[model samples]
Target: MKIERIEEYDERFEKDIIDQHGAYVINDETYAFQVLDRDTCRVTFSNRNDLNEAIEEYRFFGGHISCFVDQNGKILKEYDKVSFFDMKLEDIYVSQFYVSEEKIKRLLPYVKEFLIPVAKIDGKMVSLDGHTRMKIAQLKGISHVNCYYEEAGDYAKDFMEEAQQRGIFHVYDMPLLSKEEYEEKWHRFCDDFFEQRKAL
Candidate 1:
């Protein structure tokens, strides 16, 4: 739950990764996957409905959450930095949706337990979850936050291994986006997604 807010981006690393491998990079030393752009969220959940569902279940594993208070009595939340790119955005048409900002604002006063997910690595705290809550806190100008640390483990490796054992290949693994496809499709997908959310 305790995470450092990013003050800037390493444009150099981002450029290098995009130019060299068509991937986006996070400067692990100082950056976080804090940008919650629709594209990035789509990439994270892309073609991974099972994982998205798993995340939803995992989110409530514990009924209680811890909060941190700054000297000014402000509540803080946890946020993490992550990487994003085109390959990551493929087949993301059916991922889970995000919590509405209005909902968060409305529930803030009644929230008794606020969860901020983090990984503890050799005494250093790193964010593993709760981007939406953190963004809400930032918008509210509440700078105090806290979290419970989970031991560092190879979650991605373990998840993928289990997936491979079960013969699960996400849709994104199949093919690269043709330039025409990206131009004609991705934007429309985003537009449709927002419209649907608005209707909801």
Candidate 2:
């Protein structure tokens, strides 16, 4: 959809989520959102046991909650991170601004989720937001991610351009891996992580 402002995008996101998972309240002064697909995600309320239990049930029943589940059927609490190489960063935003090292350092401690906003660019999924989050993830060397994406509507390009002009968005012309390549990389990364864990 065409998002003129961040608030508008957030509103649309909340509405779409509520439509799918019903309504819920946030707890712990934090919001936990689960990505459903390319266009929808739901927020998991914090203190509301009913809502949390419902989500746990959905996740237990093979729902795509985008978080890790242990063998005991419990969600592992960790910061949501994604591989920088798995993301598409070309022609999605406008500016090519540099990320501040200090900003990344400060945000790393409290990063519960790296909320990547993705949209279609020439039939390929490209990042529409979350440059800072992605950079932080890359720096921290983590896998798995908590991200959200929406399919671009007719006015997507115009909206992106407008946002870029307003300094609200930036674009990257980074090289993207093919699907096969990405899969190979993902497996390699996982293997490396496990190997390192074993060594430790």
Query: Clash pairs of candidate 1?
Result: 1-147, 32-81, 32-82, 33-81, 33-82, 76-144, 76-145
* Residue 60 lDDT, candidate 2, scale 0-100: 30
TM-score for all models, in order of appearance = 0.27, 0.33
Worst 10 residues of 1 by lDDT: 87-96
TM-score of 2: 0.33
Residues 65-163 of candidate 1: C-alpha lDDT, one tens digit per residue: 222222344433322432222211121111112223433444355343234545543343443444345445545655545455444344433333433
**Following a full C-alpha superposition, what root-mean-square deviation does model 1 have from the true structure?**
19.5
lDDT of 2 by residue, 1-200 (tens): 11111111244345533322333333322233445342234444444444444444433322223553333435543223323324433334522234444435544655655556566654545454455566666556654445445445444565455445656453332223444564465346546756776798
Highest TM-score scorer: 2
